[model samples]
Structure formats: structure tokens, C-alpha cells
Target: MPELLDPRNDFLFKRIFGSEENRDVLLTFLNRTFMEANKPLLSEIILLNPYTDKDSPTDKQSIMDVRARTTEGELINVEMQLFNRYDMEKRTLFYWSKLYTSQLVEAQSYSTLQRCVTINIVNFKLLKNEQYHNVFHLREDRTGIELTDDIEIHFLELPKLDAGSISLQQGGLANWLLFLQGATPDQWEVLTMNEPKLKKAMTTLEFLSQDREARMRYEARQKFLHDQASLMEAAKNAEIYGFKSGVEEGVKQGIEQGIEQGIEQGIQQGREEEKKQTALRLLRLGLAVSAIAEATGLSEEDVHSLSQSLE
Candidate 1:
């Protein structure tokens, strides 16, 4: 069955902010989170690349990209982090610095640099001391003086939040965060006291979550995420296998590909290579041509040729 509320599920995430309309909805929600005055706020907030190392050729390097800037001149970068890589903190700082620096052109002064906010939705805890959802702003360490208002960082640890304890009136953003992290088939009735816009937001989320098309979209996203994770794992495995006195994994991948071609030549080559490799002990065990052919999805003659070649 398709999952209803997994952020890793692409469909659900897209349903949240994938399209222009949905993005509009989310932008509105984010604005409300700030308690911004009811004026025309953010006009356009575009999603850019989310991964830290954009230039890296490795498939494992690229991650889900989600960054945007508001119309009223506020920048927001949101990332959905699954694993706690050692460099996450550093990478976030680097991105923030890069974004901050990119604002100033050859002639523009640093004073013109607008305020930017980054929200990281990490599945794992980030800071060691602060356990709850935390927001960081620049301030003087000794005298508690405000350094600058141009930057803000908010970190939400999904596993650390509890929806029941959060108040609808006092904790608006907190409620929203809880809703996002809440389990599937959540009791919507308990959340009726939220702000009007948040009520609308929940309605939207509920409608999208229940829709069949939305379900399919979420399934497709899950598949994509799964494929990406698999690719990264495969690359890591390849690198590891390359390092150790072992080419067995590489040879195994190649032979598996060959065997999938159901043709005589392909099967013969696959079996011959497999049989000779001491690493593949199962292949070394003698078996009838028909038996080998059946097991590997190769024809009997092809298996016989492979057996002969191996001898």
C-alpha cells in the first residue's frame, strides 16, 4: 500500500509544494508562520538544487533540491535530510555563506543584502545541547547584543516533536511542524482550533492525501527516492569492493546483466565467466546443462558451451 504522509515519498512532498498552486499555498503558510502583516508578501519563491555538492558527478552526491526566495525580499532554503552525514552542519553553513555572498554583485554594497532564512527538516538531531526545535539568530556572545538581522536558521527535528503538547494559539509554527511530522490518518478534529489559514492548509493536505492521483504521485516519488538511495548504496559498495582485494561485486553485476539478455551468446559468456571465478562457489558446483540453463535462465546449449569454456 502507498504511504500517506512520508516526506521521503516524492508524491506527498510534491503535493505539499511541487506545483505553482501548492507552492502558493505553502508560501502563504510560511508567511503566517512569521506572523507577517496582511500585505502582498512573497511573490515568487523558486525551488533550486537541494544537494550540497551540485557539481559532483556521482549520483550519490545529488539530493532533493528545495530552495526559494519570497517576493517581499526574504530567502528560504528548506532541506529534507534523512541521514546525518558528518558534513551536514558545515555544508549548511557553506550554502548559507554562498547564498549570502551571491547577493552582492561587483558594485552592490553589503548593506543591500536582504534577510535570508534556512529551515532544515532533519530526520536526525543536529545540535547536541538543544533537543527541541531551535532557531538560531546572530547575537553577541558576551553582552547579548544583536549583530545583524540578515540571517536566521531554523532546525526542526521530526522525531523530537510531540503534537499533543503543542498549543494551537501560542505555537502556530510548532503546530504546523507537528502536523507535518504527525502520523498518517491523524485526528484532524483535534487541530480545528488552528488559525483560519492553517485550517485551510490542513484541508488542502487532507484532500491531497486522500485523492487517488495523489496516492499514485506519492508512490512514484517513493520509488524515485528508493532508486536514488539504491544507486548511492551501489556506488558506495562499488567503491568499497574496488578498494578491497575483491572485484567479485563488479564481475557479479556484469554477469547478472549478461544473463538478463536471454540470448545464447550472452548466456554462454555469463556462465563461463561465473564458472571460472573461485569467488562464485555456487557456479563452480557441477550441474547438468539443463539444470544450469534453468537456474540462470539460459538455454541448455548455451550452458553446455559455458561449461566447456570453463573446463
Candidate 2:
């Protein structure tokens, strides 16, 4: 095994858990996931879009996720996201709606629509909680009554998975997530021993890791993911810097303008106060109010008020 491929890298994830030969692998993972969520488990999952050599990086529309249907006819889409686009909430809703609505066709009754579930395995932290997995559905706000069972969404933020705290006795989901996170050979040996189904997933990864062509495609996909992450990160950093610079510049200009206005008002007020004092002195010396008003540049009303203050 030449450095086992990371299953979180969507392409390798398809090879490990989305291939027809690895159907059991996907089934086990799904069961574990549902068990953790306290939802009903599936007996079998039919893979509609399995991995193929023709799944090129250029033709990605169909090969983007592991599309499956359960024996109960519920549609399920599982995707591995290597980077956070910062729109996971709305993006997940958009994709879920697409999947839910895609089930209907022209002249088809709304009754024909099956329950659709979307599982997003994101590499970055998505939820504020420390828990690694969460599920959502349409429900009444005050009452806990569910509108329907036709829509379901799950988010498994891999970065929040606590490897040390995971106990195989508790569940197999933790083990499966760790395997996807690219567990070391030694770690897999222990994890696989506890979860028998993970053996196939590990074996698939090992077989695919050494294939020269697969490695080439994997590297291409890896490069694209990394480049996309870098580009998004650069854009986010630039936006923050731009906002900070704009705020600082605005504050600096506002402070300077405020100081200038304050100084101008102070000078005007001081000149007016001097005029009032001169008018008072001249008035007390028996000069007429009109002459004092003219000499001091004070309005007649102002001079009158000063004279009243004197009296």
C-alpha cells in the first residue's frame, strides 16, 4: 500500500464507498449514521451513480456525489466536501430542494415524490456545536410536529470528530469517519478489527492508492480542491482587509474634520465673547448703545441685552 488514499477527497471517497463493489461499505456507513441520528436504518442501498473510469474531472456534473436509493425508495445523496465555501447552510438547502424536486416529472402526481435525504461530509467545522453530526427536517416552530418525512438533511463536520474519545463499542460511525479522514495503517488495523465492514473500505483505498492512472486523476482533483480553497481564502482575507482599511480611513477623516470644526467654532465664539466684553466696558463708560453696538459689531438686540445685564 503506497500511502493509502484519503477517502475524504471526494474522488477516493467514491472509490471506497460509492463503487458498486463497495455497496456494502456504503450501506454500513449509512446504517451507522442513521443509528447515531436515532433514525430508521436501511437494509440495502442501490447505487445509481457509481464510480467509473469515464468519470473525468471535466465531466463532473454526474459524478459529484454518491447517489443512491434505499429499498424503501427514499433517494439519498452523499457528498464529501474538502473545503468550506462559507455557504453550506443555503447551499445544502438548495441541493436538497433540487434533489427533492427532481423526483417529479411532467404529469406526475405529487404523490409520486419520494423522501429525499442529503448527507454532507464537510472537512471544516460547519455547526457551532462540538458534536460532529446533526440532522434537520421541516417541522412546526412551537410544536414539534413534523410537516412531512419527504425531506431530510445531515451534516457531518469531520474536523469536529473526536478521534480520542471515539469508542467502537459506542458505534461504528466514529470509526467510519476516522477511516475517511485517512487513518494510518496502524490505526486502520485496530479500527477495522472493531468494525468489520470498514475492511472493504480500507482495502478499496489501498488498491486505488497504488494505481498510477488513479493517482494521476486523484492528484488532479486534489490540486483543483486546494487551488479553490486557496482562492476562496484569499478572497475572504482581502475582503476583511478592505473593510478594516475603509473603516480606519473613515474614522481618521471624521476625527480630522471634527477637530477642524471644533477649532473654527472656538475661534468664532472667542471673537464674539471679546466683542460682548468690549460693548459692556464702553456702555459702562457712558457711551450710547447705538455707538457701542456699531463699535463692537454687535446687533442692537445683543447690545440691549448687555445693557439690561448692566442695570
Candidate 3:
């Protein structure tokens, strides 16, 4: 038997549930996902960025996420992320803000903005909890009062899903998550027997996996994504190492300069100058202002001022 393609590949993911013909499959999956999270079920959705098969193999620059608008005008964006970038929290909030604000024209009021939901299917674990499915909302800390139902984010950690314990008969969202994680042929057979929508999804996956052109495109996209992930990891490592080196140098310089100056005021000035220099170096390295401030022991406001001056 031929090996099945990983449905978590964003390209294949889009082809599976981002097309007009597969709207029902997407609808069922969304409803099940929301219900599992204890949210209202979606009755209807209109795909904003419908999937289209590429004529040639392309890089990962192509946007393959599915964007939809519900019957109530709530926006939903779903994307399969294969790598953990360590910035998903901030990235999700940024994208959610854009989606929520993009609904209105110039004269529209804030009341016209609708809720925006982001569903990220990550191949790696994100939360510290043992649960595979994690949901977020804007709620008060002490009283647990929701500020509004406008912001919703769900993370489905594929690695956290227990394949052995997942039952097709009972696992509503688990069935879909397992399928996306590339269930074996035997598993697919069993899953299809229990979930009708999943059967349709499996058919689409098999069809796309077997197509010569589609396979090439998928391979190309996968390669591009891997390359991007590798680059990001390298950059993160470099930033960490550089920060450590800077801190060490700053401490060494502070001690040496203080000893050489041999006066209370001189020592204070020396340490201050060293810290400022370290902060400047970190800023030049493109570290975030908060990170630079934390590393250099400078106030966030000072770091921001330094960053602006450098720019």
C-alpha cells in the first residue's frame, strides 16, 4: 500500500477543506471543534480564500490558510503550522486584530467590528497542560468575567493527541486531528467507517496525494517550509548566544572599569556606560525592546528610546 501524505502540510490541508466543494467537510470539522471547546456550533460558513491547485511547484510564500466568514459575520482563520516558531502567541493576536479590524470601512464605528477566531493546528505542543486542545478568550483574572466574546483562539496540538487512545466512535475532534496527523491506511479505514465527513476528507487527500503535479507542489511547499523553519531556528540560537556574550562582556567591562577608575562615582558611571553599550548592541541585533531591556537591566522605556535613536 502506498503511504499517505501528511494532511498537516498546509498545501494539502487547504486542498482538503479550503475548496468550495469540500465546504461541508470544513463545516463539520469546525462545528465539532467548537463543540468540543464548549462553544456555539457554526451553522454556515463562506470561505474567503478558497483553495486553488497551483499549476507549478512554488515556495512557502503562498498563503494556504483557510479564511471564512460565518452567517453572523464572525471571521475565522484556520492554518496548519508544522513548526513551533516560539512567537505563535503574539503572532495569533496580531493576525486576530487585523482580521477583526478589517471588517469595517473608514466611517464605521467600533461596534461594527465582529468576533475573530483563529484555529491553529500545530504539529508540536504549545501549552504546558496535558490536554491536546487548548482554547483562549478574553476574561478577567479574578472574577473570570469575559470582557467580550470577540476574541477566540484555539490550538490543537497534534503531538499531544494520543493516537492509541483515540476512538473514532467517540472522539469527535480527535478523529479529525488524527486524520490531519496522517493516519495509517488501516486507521483511515476505521475512521472512515465511523465519521462520514472524515471519509470525504480522506478521499480528497488520497486524490491529491496521487496526482503527479499536486505531489510535486506539495513536496516543494514542504521543502520551503522546512528551510524557513531552519533559518528561524538558527536566528533564534544566534540571538540567544549573542545576548549571553553581551551580558558577559558587560559584566567584565563593568568590573574592570570600576577597578581602574577606583572611585564610587567613577564606578557607577562605568557600569552605567557598559550597560548602555550592551543595550545598544542588542538593539542593533534586532532583539525586541522588552527582551533587550530584560537582558541589559534597562527600563523598557529606555530601551525603546535607544531603539528609536538607533533607527
- What tens-digit string does per-residue lDDT give for candidate 3 at 20-129? 99999999999989999889998899999898654233543437788999999999999889988889899888888888889989998989989999999999989999
Candidates ranked, most accurate by TM-score first: 2, 3, 1
Q: lDDT by residue for model 2 over 3-55, one digit each (tens)? A: 76677888878887888988998999999899989999999889998988888
Q: What tens digits encode model 1's per-residue C-alpha lDDT throughout 128-203? A: 7545566778999999788997778767777776665666566355666655665344454455455445565566
Model 3: how far residue 194 lies from native, Å: 2.6
Question: Which has the greatest TM-score?
Answer: 2
Candidate 3 lDDT: 0.87
Better of 2 and 3 by TM-score: 2
**Distance (Å) between predicted and true CA of 277, model 3?**
43
Runs of candidate 1 exceeding 4 Å displacement: 1-3, 8-11, 32-66, 168-171, 203-217, 223-311
Residue 310, model 1, lDDT? 63
Of 1 and 2, the candidate ranking higher by lDDT: 2
Of 2 and 3, the candidate ahead on lDDT is 2
User: How high a TM-score does candidate 3 get?
Assistant: 0.79
Native-to-model Cα distance after best TM-score fit, residue 48 in candidate 2, in Å? 3.6
Estimate the TM-score of every prediction.
0.56, 0.86, 0.79
Worst 10 residues of 2 by lDDT: 55-64
lDDT of each: 0.61, 0.87, 0.87
Angstrom error at residue 32, model 1:
5.2
Q: What is the lDDT of candidate 1?
A: 0.61
Best by lDDT: 2
- The count of residue-pair clashes in candidate 1 stands at 4
